[model samples]
Target: MAPACQGVAVAEALSIGVNYGQIANNLPSPARVSWLLRSMRISKVKLYDADPNVLRAFLGTGVEFVVGIGNEAVPSMTSPAAAQAWLQQHVVPHLLSGARISCVTVGNEVFKGNDTALQAAVLPAMVSVHRALSALGLQGRVNVTTAHSLDIMGPSFPPSSGAFHPAALGHLRPFLAFLSATRSPFLINCYPYFAYKEDPARVPLEYVLFQPNAGVADPRTGLRYDNMLYAQVDAVYAAIQALGYTDVEVKVSETGWPSRGDPDEPGATPEYAGTYIRNLLQRIEMKQGTPLRPATPVDVYVFALFNENLKPGPASERNYGLFYPDGTPVYNVGLHGYLPPMLVSNAARQ
Candidate 1:
């Protein structure tokens, strides 16, 4: 068993999910992170890979997980034997230990890139993984899905008139069918921060930050959207509905603002990041839903748990984390964690 860490008490019951990316060389050990998350009352975590160390760390913690298979592994999942072997090795052992893994995302943003082969293999890979789960009698308990980039949408402004890009239509049609048949959700990485950064002049900071503003009205639906995140989500719902898929639920797989960025990157500061996350937490605590799906509460996983130093991209890309590697808050959004000193050495070895 992993050594126990000190747990800091948090007041609010964490209603939001957070992405636990491990792209950094300087991250705390999974055991330590588990304690931190538990301390903060964050019950749900999304991992980009089925890292055994992480799955093992959370055993019996009752913290639910959404583990993933990376893009490079997508092609291999097309083979039934390969999929079964992968799952049995990486996932089953943890499940047997009482790990609460609710979903398996086959690939992350496979459609966003220009890789046509990866796009073609996505659905087949998902089907194979789902079949493997069924063979093991874990189908319904563990849903199989993949995350998509917002680039898949053609026109997303008027939420009611949202539609998928024509280039993506061919792949999405069958993908939606698979989701509907399996009763799984459509995971989307919606980044309002990207929109604001792209056109800060035109995009109101208040709108994206969930601050008070006049808000925008969808000309067709007549629904008022006070926040761009909700508008983006509703637009996705509209796009999904347009493709004759009303059954598949929409979930935000990733969303967050960066605490720091290059000079060119607008609205990227500690203040803006804290405001965005704090306000988002408030809305989530109230169980607020998108205008389109008012009854079905919006499911969102914040972009990252720790600022990754190794990620290759714009400065903002590596600055989305809410905490530093030492478990210190990058900017206080009312969340706190306790990283045991004993685990600090363990984390360094990793």
Candidate 2:
């Protein structure tokens, strides 16, 4: 068993979040990870799965978490009994022990492909999960929703005219309604790095990296956007509003740049990745809001915590992490986190 997280000073409060993924085998134990995160003062974390060791490690430290329901598990969750049973086992024990889990994503990027069965099951699974949460008396405590890939948007440029792809509109309309009714934010994974990597000749590195650039104007609202991240966020707001739901708030579920990549993958370097994250963190720290939604600050979760060596894809896919597996920063962004020596952590557990 892993040791209880100890010997770390309490973290100072910071609103920035990071995605904690564990697709690799060499990552440190969750107890040690909890220490690393607290030292950096990152107060929110989103995980691709509800790893009990992780939730258990953070108990009572006051870090907020957004847990996931993997794609394969979504279909089974359509059964109210199954959803209830899953939650009873995975969530209840942790919350009872004071883990601050705030959201449950039923599936990820569900409409990104043409799998009719998966598409059909996503919403029902979410519905069943919501019902189960209410049955467990946790509906008001935790939000229920899913993350979406930005491909669901059509012509995702020029924020004002943004609309959903005809193929995704049918699914998105009802999905947006559920969010509106439940008072949950619409989560979209926005990656400007993707744009620049695909066409570095056309996509300006300055604009995509949140560096100084000639801002673009949305003709309809006359809103000016200096950075691609804000533009992509407003584009999602436009898409949601077009469906006749203005109350649903839009939040970025994932966004990051890679520190390394294959030869063909352009703009994937530590310099670009560090600059992007540092700038974004600065904006988030200042509570900066998008031009369209000037009053409400954009809520974002940076893509990942550590670069998982085993992640399958281009090298960039495995490189979207702020830190390496040893809990060292991939590139320094002034966040001085600490990881105990392996022997120290193991001895503490023993």
Candidate 3:
């Protein structure tokens, strides 16, 4: 077993989850990361893929996981044999060892891409995965769903006027039906940072960063929204309600501010990033919910645990991490983690 970070213990527990993305080569081993997460008192984690090393590392740690089946693998999940095989290999082993696997996301942001074939396969894949889970008697225990990009929504302003893009409606109708029938949550990646970056001249940084501002009032419902995150979430709720489904829940699958960016990427500073996370954490700690669903607390997973050096795209893409690879925090958001020393091969043998 890998050693735990020395002198590290649980601090103030936050109900928020963090995304454990591993699109980098320099990241600490999963065993070491397990200790880091525990030290920070983060009980929930979201992975873009069902990585066995991570699952095995967190076994018996009492951390709940939301694992994903990648986009390329979605089509194959339509086959019962394929889906069952996947669960047996990647998920079942860890579950038997006491790892809490609460949800399985069949695909990530399928509609955002231009691939029509992938868009059509997403729902079928989810159905097959859900069926396989039922066959294995793990249906109610593990909810099957998919995460969507905010681009799936048509007009997200006014909150009450929110609707899914007509191009995506055909796929989303059945998608919402599946979520409603199975009592699963609709997961969306909400990035208020993007809005500010896209239109810094017009968009108010205070609104997006959860800072104190006059706030915007939705003209239709007259609901006051102080933060863009809540507005985005409420818009999603409205979109789902428009589809004639109110039984489904909506959760933020990924949301974070980049601490750095290119020349063109605005509002990607450490200060803004820290403020966004800190303020969001404060609200989440208060058990706050969106304007549309006042009774339901907003469920969110901050996007990325560590800076990924190998990630492709803009500079900001690689800078969303809350921590550096060595476990040092990128900014002080009241979160501290310790990456245990790497285990040598000889140590493993011992």
Off by over 4 Å in 3: 1-12, 343-350
Better of 1 and 2 by lDDT: 1
* Candidate 3 lDDT by residue in tens digits, 188-215: 9999999999999999999999999999
lDDT of 1 by residue, 27-139 (tens): 98887888778777888999999998998887766789999999999999999999999999988888888998999999998878899999999999999999999999898
The alpha-carbon RMSD values of the candidates against the true structure, listed in the order shown, are: 2.9, 2.5, 2.4
Candidate 2 per-residue C-alpha lDDT over 1-350 given as tens digits, one digit per residue, 9 for 90 to 100: 22333333345566689899999889999878877887788879999889998998788778899999999999999999999999998899999998888999998998888788999998899889999999999988999999999989997779988889999888888888899888888999999999998999999888988899888888888888899999999988888888899999998999999999999999999999999999999999889999989899999999989998899999999999898888879998888888878776667555
Task: Rank candidates, TM-score, best first.
Answer: 2, 3, 1
As for TM-score, the candidate ahead, 1 or 2, is 2
- TM-scores for all candidates: the values are 0.95, 0.96, 0.95
